[model samples]
Target: MVTYSRAALFILVVFGIGFAIGSTNLPGAWYAGLTKPPFNPPNWVFAPVWSVIYVLIALAGARTWERAPRGPGMLLWTAQMLFNFTWSPVFFTWHCTGIALAVIVAMLLAIIGFIAERWQADRAAAALFLPYLAWVAFATLLNAGIFLLN
Candidate 1:
């Protein structure tokens, strides 16, 4: 169903912001220099995976906002976004894998909190985050393993 409503605009704006942030934080020279585990995905994989994840995130956020404006879930959502924005900078820009793991862990927890709290208000909204939650879980493990290996 095509939507041209406020929620659609909100989701598009969120997606644009997320896309900009992620595009600017690409793992350039600093990431290439790092040691990687055998399971590390090829560099090309991240963009597609994160693109889908970001769409899901935008949908989840817009759903939650539609259900409850200025609510606790929104706070959790903001917290997750804050920490989400930190991971790439910490890992790629700062070259601090360990700190990046911490950042992802916090982001994961915030996603969980957002899901849990959001579920009460909008089950569909909470359900939308399941994929994001799963991805972050995988990312947290990957980050942890990278930190330990390198």
Candidate 2:
């Protein structure tokens, strides 16, 4: 049985922490000056997209935690969240695109690992990660593009 309180707490923590970190480490003049790829979405699109993604991420995490707190799925979920939280600071504040790319790649890998780990045990958790994976893949390309161009 899923615990509503635990799910709500995970959702709030995931979304709130991500929003706080993102708001604090927003793209500034440096990001604006970079030559972005044509595929890059407008700056305004990120917040809403992330808002939805974070909720999905939280739900998957809560479900995985419920199923097996100490399992590989939870480990991958934690790994991805750590990498996710690290990217904005490295890319926007510290201005380390190469390092940020590395972080994001690791994050992408962790997300894939999470999905694979959850596939047999919890298909819903795995399904929840599909959009997150797609977005991160696109973001990885964008990061690589920016690193190459600038």
Alpha-carbon lDDT of model 2: 0.95
Q: Which tens-of-lDDT digit does each residue in 17-102 have in candidate 2?
A: 99899989989999999999999999999999999999899999999999889988899999999999999999999999999999
Considering summed lDDT, which 10 consecutive residues are worst modelled in model 1?
1-10
Alpha carbon lDDT of each predicted model:
0.82, 0.95
Which regions in candidate 2 have their CA more than 4 angstroms from the true location?
none
- Screening candidate 2 with a backbone cut-off below 3 angstroms (N, C-alpha, C), the clashing residue pairs are none
- Best TM-score among the predictions, by candidate number: 2
Minimal lDDT window, size 10, model 2 = 1-10
Question: Which residue runs does candidate 1 get wrong by more than 4 Å?
Answer: 1-3
Query: For each candidate, what TM-score against the reference?
Result: 0.90, 0.98
Clashes in candidate 2: how many?
0
